[model samples]
Target: MDPWVSLDPPMPAGARARAGEPGGARELVTGALADGTKRGDVGGHLELAAALGAVVPRPASGSTATLWESLATLGAHDLQLARAVEPHLDALAILDEAGVAVAAGPGATWGVFAAEGPGVRLVARPDGERWLLEGTKPWCSLASHLSHALVTAWVDDRTRGLFALDLRDPAVRTGEHAERWVPRGLPDVVSTPIEVEGAAVTPVGAPGWYLERDGFAWGGIGVAAVWYGGAVGLARRLAQPVGRELDQVAHLHLGAVDQHLTASRAVLAEAAAVVDSGGVTGSAAAALATRVRSVVVASAEGVLAACEHALGPGPQVGDASYAAALADLRLYLRQHHAERDLAALGRQAEHEGPWWTTRSAT
Candidate 1:
């Protein structure tokens, strides 16, 4: 079987053309995988991200589909690589949305450390003309490897603001809680807490602007695209020939996988179109993102179950790539706050009322 052949859906015509170009995203990832690059190799993954950064378009560009396609292609190749690259792309997008010029030197990778935790709070205080972040920020993934990060810190008792920090700042320290990240999937992509004292930061957008912007919704959906791609990667493994006659049960499972992936692809494409058209804004963009993410989550979970039931323990135990892919996807899907997100979507729908009404023909 061809390495690229699988249950994966077709990319848009333009996306396919860009991906097929020599030294494009597809060629870069395929070459890296062929060279036996490990998923946990953060340095190698960061380098790949820097190279792809020059090629992949930012989200909501006229071709949002191409941006998502690039993300999906990365996820399908290696979830850990996707994990490393996603935030870098997201940081760039956030900066763009905030009207901040990305003036970093070449090969400068970034991460967005916005997740807040109890007992440790990062706060930004005015220091003359500059802002200084002082406190601990949890879930700073690849902080040590990255050159800069767009971090969220408390600006006051009731507000949080986005700030950009240079990780190389002498006041910044990482690996505070590294040992706590021992999960089997994407184990190498450690999200440890970081401590900062008097680390100078540049304010990105106004306080509360990060979460309020439409791009936040678009970024969430972009992540779901990556999840969808990881599922596609797993589904492709199910179609791999095992040098033996496949049974009916296996074929049935493959069909089910196709069903889920097809639905997921449709939703992602629709979401991309909605984003590009600017039809959804403010609360509506968040609602659309919630809906798209919920659907993709279900589809990815279904694909995982189907693959496990169909392939049995043989591949899980014998195939290293299959095992790693399954593990990485499992852990990555946890980012979707499952029931909490569904409940939020439910609230949004309830407030909107009758969201499924058909339009009248003129």
Candidate 2:
């Protein structure tokens, strides 16, 4: 089978071999989880993190480019599972930036609970030698098995702090409303509201450091990589000769999807190179992330539409893997926030001037 062209540099040998397998998408995730028993975390599966070079620092074995490629590979496999795993790796990126040490061993997985939306209010109070978290945290992913979590909570009316909490503690309660996660799209990911009362925590960084850091926007772009991967997954099916007998209209749709995916990959690759070079910082980081995310999101939306129009509903209903990939990508892409985020970008662009005027020779 011919692989879809998404990244600039071709997929690595190991990743390529895995992507080429029969039922490879499901198999990799299952194998990753199974490998967890070797270390100590019987139910944990973080092999994807290590594979994506997310567990190790860029200077060590991973780079921004490698991380994005690995995320795209994972997205090609199973996106609901990919969605489940992305937060953990994103948490690692945050912790690394904050000088927080997290072991990438089997059972020592981490999660991020910084979704500071309404309905949950987690407060960190100073306790003797440590800190305790009080209140509920909404949208806590992998709350059941995560050994630790990088949580964001309101420190004051105007300040927020990031804390590292040990979920192994008895005071923390997860799955408070597991029933509410009824979306079939990412059902198994299990992102439910959590209740933490007097749960001890370690301060990760100074107040406001978490959001102010460059990694925050970098992480957003990292998520865009995953979204691109999902788009690739959808496009791969269209690339095949098996879909709908391959007509001229289908060929046109495939060409559009291929162009969209290629453009997205190139944009992401450039963004990664810029971040790795430390070119993204302060307001510049936000601008770059917004720009890359917008392009990738648009590309994904276009690919998804072209795929559906070309392939029809037969594949969606008959092919389990294809169906799941479509559903997962659709739901995961919602992270883009559509016009809201675009509007925010527009507001920023109004102050920053046009892209062509600011272009510099790299």
Candidate 3:
């Protein structure tokens, strides 16, 4: 039997081949995980990413569907692996956007440490012809393992800049407060604090360019794609056949899961098209991301609830994959920002005319 149903629409035979069809991401990840490679092994995950380099298309490269599908495939197999690889891909995309040449050396893994927290600040200052970063950065996932990172730091009180730095630099310290990241979901993917003192860095783009670029929105939607995939992985448990036939109640839950996943997949596909077409720019891209993320988050949450209702505690305890997927997805979906993002979308939608109007109605 197939691992999971394909959430994407049909594509041309040649396009499918280019999009990592046949034994692509699914085979690579499945084979790796089966070979005693732990999900939390950051080094092993980086090797997987390197192996998948040929297949995983970069976002907005006219094969956005392919890129997302590959990510979904990873998430389906293991969310921790997906979590480890997604930021590396995003960092490469960001560097490409800023016209920086990516010298991806052997085993060179990258991450984006852009999250800011209260009372913790990383500052960047001019150092002759180069830039140096000081202070601390929070939410640096897999920091100890990653060789490079794109860090966002305050250049001034009102300005923040994005800089690429070598994590191996002696001035950079990771795993501060290491004991604080005790979570059930994604326990292997530890996100800790890092401290850097006068670490030499390379500026990727102008101040504020990271958030202003259209890729920022595109990256956000990419994360939603992973969430959708993780939910799909969880929902697959419902499809497994036991010795006896499933009753009507089980069937009902499966149907609902299908509905939610299908909707989420549709929006992601639509957003990918918009991004590749370059039809939306500036704030429009942000709006598109907000809308896509909102739809995916709701669908993922609904699927999560339905899976728990349908499968009950048997799979939760009996199936390691199912249980880990459940926890990882629940934690991963929290990245959506919940009500705050919805409120922002609401503010944007208020000025638009009607929400329910169809093209035929117009």
Highest lDDT model number: 1
* Candidates by lDDT, descending order: 1, 3, 2
Candidate 3 matches the true fold with a TM-score of 0.91
lDDT for each residue of candidate 3 in 167-218, tens digit (9 for 90 to 100): 9999999988888988999998899999999999999999999999999999
lDDT by residue (289-317, candidate 1, tens digit) is 99999999999999999999998889889
Residue 209 local lDDT, model 3: 95
Off by over 4 Å in 2: 1-6, 9-62, 102-106, 241-244, 358-362
Q: Which residue pairs of candidate 2 clash?
A: none
Candidate number with the higher TM-score (1 or 2): 1
Question: Whose TM-score is higher: candidate 2's or candidate 3's?
Answer: 3
TM per candidate comes to 0.91, 0.85, 0.91
Q: State the lDDT of candidate 2 residue by residue for 107-205, as single tens digits.
A: 466788888666659988787888888998888877886777899987887888999888877999886777777775665677877888898788888
